[model samples]
Target chain A: MLEIKNLKASINNKEILKGVDISIQPGELHAIMGPNGSGKSTLANVLSGKDGYEVSGELKYQGKDLINIPIDERAQKGIFLAFQYPTEIPGVNTNNFLKTSLNKIKKARGEKEMDTLSFIKMIKEKSNELGMNENMLSRQLNVGFSGGEKKKNEILQMKILNPNLAILDETDSGLDIDALKTVAKGVNSTRDKNKSFLVITHYQRLLNYIKPDFVHVLADGKIIKSGSMELAEQLEKTGYKGIN
Target chain B: MLDFKPNEKEIEKIGKFSIEEKNFRIENLKNFNSVGFPNKLVEDWKFSDLRHIVSKNFAKLDLKLKPSKEENFDFIKDFEHNYIVLVNGRLTSNSFQHEDNSQIVINPYLNKDFSNKKEKNPLINLNYALSIEGFNLEVKDNYKFNKVLVIYNLFTKDLNENILNSQNRIKIGKNSELHVFDYVINKSEKNFFNNVYEDLYLAESSVFKNISIQKNRSNGFFHKFSKNILSSKSNYSSFIFPLGLKFDKLDLEFNLEGENIECNLQAASFLNKGDHQEIKTRVNHLAPNCKSYQKVKNVIDLDSKGVYQGKIFVKNIAQKTDAYQLSKAILLDESSEFDSKPELEIYADDVKCSHGSTSGSVEKDSIYYLMTRGLSKNESVKLLINGFLSEIIVSIKSKTMKNFIEQKLLSQIYEH
Candidate 1:
């Protein structure tokens, strides 16, 4: 469902992703493990179509040219990225922002938009499942949210959007044990036969809840090794220094 | 020194008015000289330099012929109520259709021998002596008028180029409610001047909401002043929305004379090109336990300029006064500029007063974020600008006025 070939990317005239390659099929869960400065976040940013980066590569999603598509177009094509640091927009309620974004995505996909009542109902249900209180939806988006609350809020958005390819970029970094389990449960409920995920993290603790199908060792912006779930267990025991 | 003198030919042309108006003009000129436009030495006019804008001769507009219904002064075509229409500076006969229990009074200046009070400002004296007509509208006590009172000030052309001097007085009796809409629409293309004065008196327990819409032509210059006083337990709300004009200045003063009175003043202006607009407001809490709120917003593009000066004063006797003032502006281009000054003077120790002023351009990071979401640069900028201005529009209590402002903002967006 996703393919990257010899992808070279740079930020501020400095190369970050040097000839990186990855491929994932439908229903597959891929984990990319790397140390600090291994270009993990840069990879996610490039896939999301953020500007200010010089990228030269061939990226295809379901046989479409993904590199040239805009960020919102990528989102409309069922691509979602859970940011490690969510933005805070003051004076804009979370529910209103989500409704506007969701309607735009639905309109782009030629789907019917929900009315006010249905929209409110959907938000109430999803927010309840994520353990978010009713008042959180009425407040400004992430204006004064705690660390754990922001992560859960991102999970809530992912569940509402129901994207085809979800990229969880260190979503478990700042979450507590309880929040981690809750977030993992939310992700597990949305997993389907046709959906895929690319989980990027430095620690393997999150792997205990959402197990990976395949684990790839990424170092110096290149994948050096690939194996089954056991590879994650081994990395957890011993750091990336010996494996590389 | 700036050249503040008016052209000799222009003064000679305006000398053809009726003998009464000519005499009034001479008296106003003498008064104007004594109180010439306050210079930078004055505190209130510190930021605004009036000498550059006010003419030397400053002739008063002549009273034109009586206006008619065909001139489109009727706000609601099918709906009927007491309506007064003023063209130039003359009140047309049969212009107002008075209903039962409502009194229509015009030109109180001639009826009552009232002297001009001592106001350090010269403009007050000039406006008093050269007042064309004063509208005295009274709604009977305990009477509920579901219809709105529309005062249409239409500017039409005349052979002589002179300044328009108009005054309006409105009184709401005790326990009465009324919705007053004052529209300043200019269709003239000549170099015209306007001086408008409005005085509102709200009785005890009465409710009054005034909305003023100014859409002047490119060649028009306007100077409008309004004073409102509220009685005990009364509610007064005022909104000023100015759309198009070359140069416009508005000065408003509100006095809370009774305890537990509620007052709100909101003004918004959108300008483009070489247009200039200024708004100055002062709210005074003279009674105990009074509440006042003020919000002023402006959006300027091209080479336009805007000025906002707001002041809140709480007297020593007025304890428990709660007042808040905010002034915000957004400049869309490098050539555009905005000047904002917000001041709070409190003599009471128990009063709560706060004022904030902010001037900024559109957030580039927010624009980039929107653009990354598949919107073009123009669309992103327009969306952000709309969101910024809609903060004031959403606060409007009238749905019709809100929709009107939305349409105006959209048109401005498209034009830019």
Candidate 2:
């Protein structure tokens, strides 16, 4: 579902990701665990086609070159990135934005757009399953929302859009235990053979909820080790310095 | 440059006035002719070079203009209310079936008080000199209107290189209440100028709310100077949506004359396609325990220019006065321009007065976040602009009125 080889990304003439490589098949969940500023978020940003990055690497998604695609086109082509710090957009109702976004993606993919009635029904169901207050969807997008509510809103978006490849960039960082479990449950419910997830995290707590098929240790902009859940447990015990 | 200077014959054409009124007209006309149109040298006209803009746009401006045809205009079907229709700044017709006729007095404006005050704005001088038509509205004491009054100011298509000046006054008696929607609809295809002078007086314990908006884009150069006086315990609120004109300027002044008055002024505008707009306001806290607030927001597209100059003054006797002012702008492109100046003058040490102004391009992070949700760059920027302006629109308490104004605002944004 996704492939990368010798991926390097830089901004302002400073290199952040250097020769990092990762690969995942359809239905596989991959985890990239790294300490602070280890290019984990950079990888997610570069994959989602954020501008201002001087990127030179072999990055392919679904056997197509993804480097030249614009950010919205990549999103339309089934790529979703859950931001670490969700933006608080004032005066924009969450439900209205979601509807516009869903319809745009739907039109780009040659699918019928959902009307307001059905869209409301679908959103109500998805938010209810995640135990989010229905009123949150009517308020301004993430404006005055709590940290946990913002993260859960991101997961709720992931469920609504139902993208092919979802990149979770530190989605579990600020969540409490209950929120973390609900986020995990939301992710677990959407797992299927046709969808893929690249869970990027700094701690092993999130790993205990939704187990990853493979885990890679990212240190100093490079993946130094690749293993399973055991690798995350080892890192929690010894830290990044213990690996070397 | 075309001569905007008017001769005495034009004043005579208006009517036979008393000696005092005639002298007032002659003095103001002389003042207007001396300055012609205000230039960038004037402190209040620095951001707006009216002299240069007028020279570039008009070859000749006719001072005497008569409506040639009975123009048709659509009354707003969005809400039920009483309405007054004005064509080319001349009051044409009105209906007040929703109110007690005895409590309401509406008539063609005849300037009664000929008190001569030296005016600094040349446009105001011009209005006083050549003004002929408008409406004088007075509500009887303790009478509250059952429905909102809609003033439909329409400019006909026959207007070309013409200038129209009018004076309007609205007085709410003690303990009376009124709400008004000043709707302007222009059909003029060629360039014309419209100058308006409005006076509002809120009596003791009276309440007045006014919402002013433009219907669509037009080839109109507009200027309006509104002066409001508030009495004890009276409340006055104004919302202005000035959009889609070749050139527009609103000079507003409010005087809190009595104790415990509350005054609020808010505006949201979308300027595009080389449109120019300026809003200058001065609010005076003359009484104790009064509160005043001013907020103006603008979105300027390519080649458009927007300006806001707001000032708050608190007198020495006006202790415990609270005043706040803020101006925010979003420039969409390099060619777009926004200029803001906020001023506060306080002689009362116990007063609370604060002012702020900000102007910048839209946030790149906000665009990126929206794009990640499958919205294109254009769509994302549009959504952000709408969101920025909707903060003001949502303040309208009536949902139907809010939606109507929101649709008009959206059309202005999308027209670009």
DockQ of each model against the real complex?
A: 0.25, 0.91
Residues B111-157, model 2: lDDT tens digits: 76777776889899899998987999999999999999999998888
* Model 1 lDDT per residue over A44-122, tens place: 8888888878899889898788888777788878888887777665545578767766777788789998788999999
Over the stretch A1-244, how does candidate 2's per-residue lDDT look in tens digits? Answer: 9999999999999999999989999999999998888999999999999999999989999999999999999999999999999999998989999999999999999999999999999999999989999999999999999999999999999999989999999999999999999999999999999999999999999999999999999988999999999999999999999888
Residue runs of model 2 more than 4 Å from their true location after superposition: none
DockQ score, prediction 2 = 0.91
CAPRI grade of model 1: acceptable
Model 1, which residues run further than 4 Å from truth?
A1-20, A24-43, A54-244, B1-25, B33-70, B73-126, B140-147, B156-162, B184-186, B189-191, B214-219, B398-404
What lDDT does candidate 2 reach at residue B31? 84
C-alpha lDDT of residue B232 in model 1 = 90
Residue B189's C-alpha lDDT in candidate 2?
Answer: 94
